[model samples]
Target: MAALFSKMLTKTDIESCLCIRASPLGQLPFEEGQRVNMHVHDESGQEWIFSCSIEEDENVGRFVSVGWLEFARFKEILT
Candidate 1:
């Protein structure tokens, strides 16, 4: 499948406190408050499913919430 977007993980990304920010310019197909299943694949071709909700903020626009930190941890991402 084609990628919707990509980000080089930062220290904050692996932290459990934050969610992955989707680009405002990317214009995701889903609507706000919509729950979507995200398929994440690692470099080794390992795949993980994240059940995320689309959240909108006045300042940040859209972001993927829930299961991101777990995905990072499962991938053993250090950064």
Candidate 2:
């Protein structure tokens, strides 16, 4: 049970952290409406703890990024 919880929470952390790093204009190469999933762990010793891609917004530069919780729901809707 703990392991399952950890996995779920890990994704949340990654998403939260990424949102902080993404541009407000959404111009950082991520598609406006695409969902990205990646493992975020600090063992690699890099500034970036994970990798991501935005795969779908019509106006990539205009779509504002939301918090992790909201983005998760948005991604679900996109799918």
Point to the candidate with the largest lDDT.
Answer: 1
Residue-level lDDT tens digits of model 2 in 26-72: 34545646655544333354322234444334443333233344444
TM-scores, all candidates, are 0.59, 0.24
Poorest stretch of ten by lDDT in candidate 1: 16-25
lDDT of 1 by residue, 1-79 (tens): 6765566755655665345577733676677678778787787888877777777678877777655667666667645
RMSD of each: 3.2, 12.1
Candidate models: Cα lDDT each: 0.67, 0.39
Q: Once superposed on the true structure, which residue ranges of model 1 sit more than 4 Å away at CA? A: 1-3, 8-12, 17-25
Error of 2 at 75 (Å): 24
